[model samples]
Target: MSSGDGRAPGPLLLLLLLLALPRSAGRRRAVVNRSIPDVCATCHIHATCQQSGGKSVCICNYGFVGNGRTHCQDKDECQIGASKICGNHTLCHNTHGSFYCVCLDGYRASNNNKTFIPNDGTNCTDIDECEESGLCGHNARCVNTEGSYMCYCNDGYKLETGEHSFHQDENNVSCKEIGCGSPPEMKNGYIVGNYSVQPGSAVHYECREGFYSNEGKFSYCTENGTWEPATLSCKEIDCGKPWLIPHTTMTWDNSTTLWSRVYYHCKEGYYFNGDKNFSECTMDQSWENITYVCEEEELFSNLSIFNETCVRWQKKTGRLGVQEMYTFHVQGQRWYQKNFFHEMTFELFTHKQAPEVCLDLQPGTNYSINISMVALNFSLLVSMTTQITDPPFPEVEFVAVKGSAPLLRLRKAEDQNGPISLYQVIVLPLDLQSTFICDSFAATTFFSNTTDIKGYVAAEFQAKDVADNMSIALGDRHYYGKFYNAPLKLGQEYCVFLKIISEWNKVRTQSCVIWAQIKNLSPSLQYMTAVGLGSVAAVCLVLFLSFSVARSCLHRSVHPPPAAVACEAVHLSTTVDVASAGIASLFLETESVSLL
Candidate 1:
C-alpha cells in the first residue's frame, strides 16, 4: 500500500500504522519485551497520554492545542463569540490548559456559581438586583438591566445632579426630597415658629393681638410637593358693654369697643370698697369682669363700754340689720410685774345693730380692749381694769410615808386663772401642820441662822422651772433656785406644804396644799445616828493615838534635867488639851448633824 513517491513511512506515521493494526494481527506476532518505555512520561506537562487502537498516544488538554510531545499552548476558546461558547450574558476566559465561563456584572449563572461550563446546561441569566435592599441610595428605586442595575429617584424626590438615573459608584448622588416653597398667608395672623418647607413639615400661625381665630392654625407640606390649604381665619375683636354694679354710678362713653373703660363711683352716703374703680373691654369679645363695690360710709359707730367687761356698738343707719363680723383684740398688763402680759384676738358675728360682747379678763390686770369692724377697717380702743381675786388652788399629789422622806411629785400649776409669782415648799413640824397658814410669810429659808426657827422653807422654785410630774426628794440636800433643801431631823415627823402665790397690781393671793406627810422615818434615822457615832469615834481614836505618840517620843529621849522635864511636861499638857478640844468639837459636829 505505498503511495506515489512514497518513502518508508515516518516514525510518527509508522506508529500510527502499528496502532491501526487489529487485535488479531498483534496476537499473531511474537511477544515483545515487557520493558517498553512509557510514552505518557515523555508528553508535555499540558498534554495527556491516552490509548487509541491498542497504542499509547499523547494529546493536548481540552483548553490547549500543540504537538503534545514538546509543547502545548493555551487555545483562545474566547475567539468565538462568548454567546455561542458560554450562552448569553457570559464571558469566556482561557486558562493554561482549560477555559472557564463567567456571567457579566448584574448577571448570574443558573447554577448560582461565579464560573461555569455550558456542558451542564449552566447558562448566565439576568440577576434581579432589586432583590437586594437599598441597592440604590435612600429615596431611590433600583431597576435591573440586561447586565447591570440603575437607580431612579422616587416620587417627590430628585437626584442632586438633576439626573433621572444613577449608578451606585456615584457616591455623591442622592435623592433629595422635594419642597413646597413658603406657606400661604393667614388673614390677620402671623407665623408663630420656625418651620421647614419639606414634605411632612408644618408651619404654625397665630392671630394678632386684636384678632382671634377659631379655625385650624397650621399649614402642612404635602408629599406631592405642594402646601396643604390652611383653614385658619382670624376676625377682629369686639367687646360688649361693661356689667352693671349695685349702688354704683357708671361713667362710660357710648363706645363699647376693645380696650374701652367704664368708671364706677358710689352713690351719696356710700363708700367705695373695691380694688379697682373701673372695668375695661378685653380681647375675649367681652368686657373684663371687675371687683367694684360700694359700702355704707360708716359701717359701725357709737361704741361704748357698759358692764366693766362688756362693750356695745351700733351699726350704720344704712346697714342697721345686716350681719357683720368684728375682730376683738385685748391686751392686758400688770403694773407691779413688768413681765406679766396677756393678749388675745377673736372674731365675732352678729346681726343686731346694737351688738354687745363681754370680754374674759384676768384679775388685777389693766387691759386695753380694741373692738374693730374688719369690713369698715375701723377700730375703737377702750381701757378697763379687772378686780383682783384669789388664785386657783395649787395642784399637788398628797403623799404620806411612815419610814422615810417622801418622794413628792410636783405637778405644774397652770397660770390661766391668775399670774403666778412664786412656788414655795414649806416644811413644818407635824404638830404645827394645823397652824400653818398659806399667807404667812414667817417661814424662813433652810440656811437662815435664827433662834426659835420652828419651820423653814426646804425648797422654792419659780413657776417657769416647774414641770408636770417633776420628782422632788424632800431631804435630798440639793438647792432649788435660791432655796436649800436641808435634811430633815432624825426621829422627827414633818409636814410638807406646797404654796403658790400670785401678786399683781399690789394684790397678793395664795393657795396651799399638803404635799406630803413623813412620820417615824426609823430606818434612815437609825442609819444617820450610827454614821454620826462612827465618825465621832473615829475622830477620837485618831486624836488619842496622836497624843500617845507624842508622849512616847518624849519618854524615849535620854535622861533630862528637872527644868527640861518640866518644860516637856508643859508641852505634853498643851498637846493633851488640844486633843481634848478636838474631841469635843467632833462630838458637837455629830450632834449638829443629827439635828438637821
Candidate 2:
C-alpha cells in the first residue's frame, strides 16, 4: 500500500533495509569525529565521512572507531594497542587502523607480543659513570658512552680493572714515573746540598768526625730565596797549648783563634838574645822568631899639697923690712884624717911647692880655699881660706926747749921682715898712777917734724908696736927730759919717761929720765917809777892857772865912771816904758797866756 509496488514485501527484505540506514548514519559520524582526514583514510575505504572544522569523518578499520564528533580512534587489540607496542627500550604508538613500535640500539624487546609504554624519554636523566665507584680500575678515571661507561688510567699508576696487562703496554692505564733527586754532602766545616727544593721545604744534617759544629742541625728553604733557621757546621781546628819559660812573662791578645802574639821578659841580672821580647803563632801552629841582654856599676883617684905664706909692706916709704912675714901648712891623708895643722905626724911641704899645686887645682882667681880634704879614693878637696894681717906700728920722738914745753914727733916703726905694725903713745902722771893720757900716732916710714904738745900736761909717754909686742919702756930708749924753766905750780920734783911698744905682741920698752932743777925769774920796776913823777907834775900846773883868773876879775869890778852910770839909768827907763805898753796891748787883745 504505500507505493502499491510488488505484492507485499517479505519480512527479511524489510529487515535488511532497516539495518542499512543506521549503518550509514554511524559511518558519517565516525568520519566527522577523526582529527586528520588523510591519516584516517590510510587504512579505510568506502567510508562516507566529511571533514567539517579541523576533524575527520571516517569508518574505523576492524577494531577501531570514532570516539565522538568526526575523529576515528583505536580499539584495544589486547586492551587498546598493547599487543602491538615495541620492546622495553621503545615507546608504543597507535593508528586509526593499526599500531607498531621499534627498540633503540643495544636493547631488545621482551618475548611477550605486547606494546611497551616507556616510562618517559625526557623524565629520567643519565647517571655520571666517572664518579661512580668500580666504574674504572685503580689509578684510572671513568668516561660515559650513550648507553654505558669505560675507564682510563692516571700518571704514575696502572689500571687493574679489565685485564692483567702491563701499564706501559697498549690497552692498559698507567701512571708516569717520578722521584726525589739526591742527598746532601759536607765540605770543610759547612754542609752543602744541591737539590731542586720547593718553597717551604726543609732538610736536616749533622757534623763530621774530628770536628764539632757549634751551630745546630737543621735548615729550610723559604719563599724569599734563602735558608731559614740555620746551616750545618763543622768543628774548629785545635792547636797545642802554650807556655813561657821560668822567670819569664808572656801575653796573648785573643784566646779563641790559633793566631796570637806572645811577649817575653827576663828576670833581674839576666840578659836576652835577638828579638827577646816578642813572638807570634804562625799558620803552621808554631810560635816563631824569638828576641834578649845582662847587669854593670862604674870606679875614680887624686893628691895635692896645701900651704900658704903672706907678707906686708909700709905705705909712706914703701919699705919692706919694717913688716913681719908668716907661713902655715894644711895637710890630710884620707876623708876622716883631714888636718889643718899636725905638728908631730904630718910632713910639711915647702911654700913654693904648695903654691904650685894649689894654683893648678884652683877654680878661679875670685874663689879662695876655705876647707880642704882628701878622699879615701885619693880624691883631693880644697876650699879657699881668708886671713887678715895686722896694721903697722907708729914711731914717735920728744924734743926739749928753753922757754916752752917739750914736744913729741910721730913716725912708723920698722920691722926687719917687712911693713910696720900699729903703735900707740900713752902718757901717765908720775904722782897719779890712774891718770893715763892717750894720743894716736899715725903710721909712716919717715919721722914727722911737727909736734903736738902745746898743753904739756902729761908726765910720761910710750910707743907701742902694731902687734903690741914691744914698748919703749922695755927697750930703755931715751925719749923724754926735764924742763929747766917749768912753772912752780907744775911741781919742781916731777919725773918724766918715754916708752916704745909693739901692739901685735904687746911688747914695750922704757926711756931713761934726764933730771934738772927748775929756776925762778923776777920782772924789772923802772916803768912804775917814771909814771908816778909825771902824774904829780900835771896836778900842780892845773891849780896855778885857776888862781890867776880869779885875781883879774876882782880888779875890773872896783874901777867904774859916774857919767856913764847916769846915761845908763835913762836908757833903762825908756826901754822899760815901751816894754810895758807892748805888754798891755798884747794882754788886752788876749786876756791870758800860759808859759811852761
Candidate 3:
C-alpha cells in the first residue's frame, strides 16, 4: 500500500497510522501532519551548509561550485590568469576547497611568507639580487631587472676573460682596467714621458739622435679598452753627398747622414795645411765647412841639417842657376818646457844649385825647418837640435814684509833659452841672503838637519807642475815635491830665494832670484802690517800704471805699425804654379772618394 504522498508504506507503519487516526474523534477529526527534510544533512561533500531567512540552507565552499544539495566541484581560480587572480608576479593554485597565491621566479611574496591567500592586499615584488654587495666581481656594476639583475663592467674596464658580463661565482671573473699593454715600438724612436692604460690617456714618442719624424707621435687609449694605433714615423737624417774639396783624397764610407765623417789627406807632392783633416755631416743637412788646403810641394833633394841651427837642400836640376826665391819656415819647442814655443818665417834669394840658411836659434831646443822654392814648385823638411846653455835669469817681483809671511807670486819663464827642469824655494836667515848662490844644492829639506843650519829647502816643484802666475805663501805648512814648507820662527828675519834648474844632454844649469824678505816676524802686528802693506801696494800700483802708460806710448812711437812683424809676403808665382798644376788629376782621384 502507498502513503498519502504516493509512498508505499509497510504493515507496521499502516497499523500505527490507523491507530492514531480513529482516536482523535471530534479533536482529532481528520488530524494529519507533514514531515520536513533536513537541509544540513543533504549538503554535498565539497559544499557547506548555512542559515538563510531563519532557515537552514546549503552552499558551495570557497573553491567549489555547485547546487549545494545535489553536487559541488572544484572551480579553477587560475583559469583567468594568476596575475589577475592572485596578483602580479604570482601563481594561483586551486585546492579541493580553496585557492592560494605563490610568487614566480625572481620574485617574493610581499607578506614575507612563501605562500599566501589573496584578497588581503598580499602581492609579489621583484627580488633585488643586486642588493648584495659583490654580486658582480670587482670593477663591475650590478643592475636590477623586473625579476632579475645583470652585471656589467665599468667604463675604462673590461672582463679579463673577454666576456661582456659576469657574476661573482664565475671562475676568475674580473674586470681589469683597460690597457694597451705597451705602445708599439717605433724605428729609431723612444717614449717621451710617463703613460697610463686608462681610457683617454696618451703615450708620447720622440725620435732618437740622428733621426726625425713629421708624422703623429702619439698613441691614445680609446673607450674600447685598447690603444689607438701609433702613427709616428721616424726617418734618418741624411745630409746627402758631401761637397768636394780640392787637391785632397777622402777616406770615408758611403753614408752621408748625421755625424758621418769624411777624412781628407793631401796627395803625393802636396802637404796638408788645414786645422781639420776630416769633415762631418751636420744636422742642417750639409757637410760643415773646413779650412783645408793642400799646398804644392817644391822640388828639393838631399835635405840636410848642420851646426845644430842651419839647413841645406839641393835644388832640382830643372831650376839650376835660376834665381829662385826660397822661403824658410821654422818652429821650435822644448820637450821639458810645455810653455815654450817659437815660430818664424823668412825669405831668401838664391841662385846656387844648393841653397843653405843659418838660423839664430835658442839653446836646449828642438827645431823644424821647411824650405820651399817657388820657381821649382818643391819643398824640403829638416830637423835640428841645439846644445844646452846657461838658463836665463829668473824674473821676479821682490817683496819685503814685516811682522808676517808674505804671499809671493811666481811667474813662469819661457823655454827660449833652455829646458826648465825644476823650481826650488830656499829659506835662509836674513844674514845669509848675500851668500846665497844660484848653483847651490847644499840647502837640505826643511825636515833634514844638515851642516848648513842657516838655510833649508822649503819647497821644490817640477817644471811641469808649476802654472803661470802661481802664488806661494811663505809659511803655509804644505808640501811641494819632497820638501815641506815649514812654519817660520817668531821674531826671525828670513830671506826667500826662487831657483830654476835645467838639465839636458849631460849639461846642467840654473838661475836664481830673491823672491821675498821677512823681518822681525810677529803675529800680533799682522793686521796692522797688512794695512801698512796695502797702502804701500796702492802707491806702487799707481807708479806701475804710470810707468806702463809711458812705456806703451814710447813703444808705439818706436814702432808705428807693430802688426808688420807678423805680416808675410805672399808670392804670386807660388799661387800661379799651384793653379796651373793638373786640376784634372784632383778630380780623377776624387771620383773614388765616397761621402760619409
Q: After superposing candidate 3, which stretches have Cα over 4 Å from the reference? A: 1-42, 49-58, 127-130, 154-156, 163-172, 192-195, 267-271, 295-596
The model with the greater lDDT, 1 or 2, is 1
Tell how far residue 449 is off in model 3, in angstroms. Answer: 89
Against the unseen true structure, what C-alpha lDDT does each candidate score?
0.75, 0.37, 0.75
Off by over 4 Å in 2: 1-180, 184-203, 207-216, 220-596
Report how far residue 142 has shifted in candidate 1, in Å.
Answer: 93
**Local distance difference test, candidate 1:** 0.75
Residue-wise C-alpha lDDT for candidate 1, range 1-596, written one tens digit per residue: 45478877668878777787866476655355455678989998889999999988999987888988898888988888889899888889877666799999878889998999789999878888888998897999998887778999998797767677999875668898899887898878999979998889999999988788767888999976689989898887766445545557888895665678889998776677768998787775666655566665555668777766787877878876788888887877654444567889899998897988998888777776666677776555466778666667777767888978877887777665467877888888899899887767433444544445567777778776677888888767787766767777656898888888776667777888888898886645556676677567766766776677567667877665677767756876676667656654543322111112
Q: By summed lDDT, which 10 consecutive residues of candidate 3 come out lowest?
A: 587-596
lDDT (Cα, tens digit) per residue for candidate 2, span 1-596: 23367577778778888999999999998888885446444534433455657866555445466533344566644343332343234545665555556444323445333333443332123344445675455566666655445555544333334243332223545432222223345544444464444545666665544345545566665544345655566654333334333335556654433456667665554445444576655444344534221111100112233343222111212322333222223321111111222221122132231223333221111121222111111111132322222323233343333322233344434432122222333322234322423232222212112342222322222323122333222112233322112231221222333323323223222222222222221212433344444444434443443354345445656554556446545655555555545543432212111110
What are the per-residue Cα lDDT tens digits for candidate 3 across 122-192?
88999999999888877889998899787899987888788887656546677888877777777899999
TM-score of each: 0.32, 0.18, 0.40
- Against the true structure, whose TM-score is highest? 3
Q: Candidate 3: TM-score?
A: 0.40
Residue 323's lDDT in candidate 2:
32
Query: Which residue runs of candidate 1 sit more than 4 Å off their true CA positions?
Result: 1-381, 442-446, 523-596
Q: Which scores better on lDDT, 2 or 3?
A: 3
- Sort the predicted structures by TM-score, highest score first: 3, 1, 2
Q: Give residue 112's lDDT in candidate 1 (0 to 100).
A: 93
